[model samples]
Target: MEETRIRFGIMGCANIARKVSRAILLTPNTTISAIGSRSLEKAVVFASENHFPESTKVYGSYDAVLDDPDVDAVYVPLPTSLHVRWAVLAAEKKKHVLLEKPVALNVGELDTILAACDSNGVQFMDATMWMHHPRTVKMKQLLFDEQRFGQLKSVHSTLTFLAEEDFLKNDIRVNPNLDSLGALGDIGWYCIRAILWAHDYELPNIVTAFRDPEYHESGVILSCGASLNWKTNGKFATFYCSFLSNLCMDIIALGTKGNFRVHDFVIPFNEKVGSFYAVDNSKWAERALGCAPEPSELKIEINLPQEAFMVQEFGRLVAGVRSNEAKPENKWRVISRKTQLVIDAVVASIKNGFVPVEVVY
Candidate 1:
């Protein structure tokens, strides 16, 4: 009897790790191998609180997880500041790396991580859960339908969640020494990724940030917005992300012939199913009244949450590498790099007096 399931070691007990641990357990081809934190007691308690299997190892140091012979991959939910150091180390250890987004402090750091993964021949994927949703796939199809969507004209997205007073004061996302980019790194990452996804991972030619982004006094961004433009095609995308508003995840994409809309692009309101609305060209009503053609509501049902699907896909890549000696999927690495490039450009735009910064990558 052969065991083909991929074993995942998670580093850090960050709150998001709790959901990822569950996703690893729920994914059919993946299993929790070890849980590690800087504090041994924290690791042990995290393993128990998360109900990890009795056989799962609890290590006090991240290096211990990477050294464990049983660990085939590592899920890194560490702070953005630690991503390059640990992700590169995990790759150096010959372990596949599933990193949380924003994957690094900047594009340069992300490249170092990617280079390590490439040199080590291990898979590299950022934890962008929504990209794996079936609903997102269907929406991409609708957007490319010549008769329906035509050329992509513009995109607008927003991802914001109200933070409790305590969270605003103490959460890692707000701590400049930790999450650093703050709201721009935490939630804005998704908005930028969504816009890039709409553009088929194409890098925008220019990025101009909105003025006076709300900042935490510590200089970490609390709320921000940016506009990306493809000068050649005259198409553009705009997005806003914040930690000081009621929760909202919306995407509106208008095309030459139609429009596409999704209210819950990051995390769907319904766990069992997700949906979006789209419309094709519709004529004006006889009396210039309301149009008769309504946008169609399309829904996608899934057996697992988007995170579990992410684990499943990542594990599939690891297994292919381990069993068949197949090359790791480079598309995921490319997708991650493009996302980081835009993030860096946005930050540069903000820093350079809200001037448009040319995207070098």
Candidate 2:
């Protein structure tokens, strides 16, 4: 039997859109049916380059794409500042949305978008590609397996990368309004998503945040870290995100009886998923499983690369979207809201010169 193909329209001609267009092409039950951009020339060029069917329509305005009854779903890769506005509009048009990260600048905006999706009965999500990766599932499993990382104690995480020089200026990262979200909001977000995933989407009871305003104008957070405590129990988590350093991404956790780590957090390849280190004692050992890393408490030097992580991960997200199985708990609105609340607390802490703010769930 032939499956129903989800007709997709792209809301921008951004480069990320090109990645998604390729993924859409790769997706089994999806099609890049239309594209809209501020400039028709750019839209036409992008659509043609991606080999979106010649019958696919190209429009100069986003509204035109939204108005296309044929577009059942929309992928919005717009700047962080515009996420809420367009997502709300798309939902009203009855088009499901796959929105990019930092879902919105604040919780208010995030709430508005979620509310709109609910009112309009459209599927909506923030594109935290990490959530879609198989490694994410594996990591969570290792955490709970009685044999590994039992009785988790503390978590430490870091995500940093050097942006390509040409991609720096006038980009969304540099725009003051859109730029209000820094490394934490931008990349550190993965850490929050990962942590929440490991904990079954439970919100931490206490959250304290800190931001480096000097590194960004518009009071954007440059380097933000949070110490989270779950009220129901005595579990604690700490996460760090930075933009002003060398390119390294990883997470390490210590449990009462074991330890676990993730070498490359962003986009780990299939082969790198289980590569990790573990110890029941205060000693070190390194071993590699050629096919896939062995399950252990401490996962380290997991050699997963960039495109391998995000591309296939996004493909899974698209698949979930097509199947109508995308959940609200995993929605970007929920993740971003938790993250923004963390950032808001961080900024308050930093403003008082690093005094900890009480994190409210």
Number of the predicted model whose lDDT against the real structure is largest: 1
TM-score of each: 0.98, 0.82
Per-residue lDDT tens digits for candidate 1, residues 203-270, read: 89999999999999677999999999997668999999999999999999999999989999989999
Model 2 C-alpha lDDT versus the unseen true structure: 0.69
**Which ranges of candidate 2 are over 4 A from the true structure?**
1-3, 164-168, 210-214, 217-219, 269-333
Model 2 collision count: 12
Location of the lowest summed lDDT over 10 successive residues in candidate 1: 1-10
> Cα RMSD (Å) per model?
1.2, 5.3
lDDT of each: 0.93, 0.69
| Top of the candidates by TM-score | 1
Q: Provide backbone clash counts, one per model.
A: 0, 12
